[model samples]
Target: MQKLATFIRGDLVYDGSLVSDATLQERFQSSIDPEVVASPPLLGPKGIPQFRKLDFTRDPRLAGVQNPTLVLWGTEDKVNRPSGARSLQRRMPNCDVHLFSKTGHWVQWERADEFNAMVVAFLAEDSADALDFRRV
Candidate 1:
């Protein structure tokens, strides 16, 4: 548990310059699954093989997606770089990209309010557009 917490604190979460220890712990605890903590397959040899296989550069399906999409990324994320978001925007015809300045891999946890608001707004806009199209 300590090792996982340390990794989350040091690597997975924000850059440690802006977030408070208490807030980080609270967010971590809230998001942590006890079962996952007990048996972490994500760290095992079979863990995240799909991630290793992911080659966005060669993925032709990205350009085929037609639905409205939103790609939210954290600028401080060490696991997945911000360039991925831009790449998705360039490939997807109807995609919007939003980057959180000081957040990390856990953008939803790190910027809960802002993330929630953006998601809600995106959905609302999509819904409205669909309704307009139906009426037309």
Candidate 2:
């Protein structure tokens, strides 16, 4: 539990500069939910092996996706870099990428209003033609 809290309060916050104590507490609590505490999906011994087997870089399935896709990322994300989002944009047929500056893994939580607005706008769009990669 202490280890999980440390990882959530430190490694997940992207330099731990922008997050508040309240936000950290909330994140930590959510991470340790009773249902997920000892679940295989959690980042435990069982989950680590599954994650290690994933090879997104050489995956050909991403190029086959024909649906319109939105890839939202944080510029300061420590877990996954901005380049991963760019890679997804390149692979997906119709994809738009947005990078939030000064944000970490919890981009939606940190910028809820803007994230909600973007998601609403994306869903409201009449056509995929209206969507394009424009960093905001």
lDDT of each structure?
A: 0.80, 0.73
Give model 2's TM-score versus the native structure.
0.71
The top-ranked prediction according to TM-score is 1
Choose the strongest candidate by lDDT.
Answer: 1
Q: What is the lDDT of candidate 1?
A: 0.80
Give the residue spans of candidate 1 off by over 4 A.
Answer: 15-52, 56-58
Error of 1 at 126 (Å): 0.3
Which residue window of length 10 is worst by lDDT in model 2?
127-136
Backbone collisions counted per model: 0, 0
Candidate 2's residue-wise lDDT over 13-119, tens digit each?
Answer: 55565656676677677767897676736342356556655636346788898877888888888777778888888888888999998777777877779999999
Q: Write the per-residue lDDT of candidate 1 for residues 76-127, one digit (tens) a residue.
A: 8887787888888899999999999988898987898999999999999999
RMSD of 2: 6.1
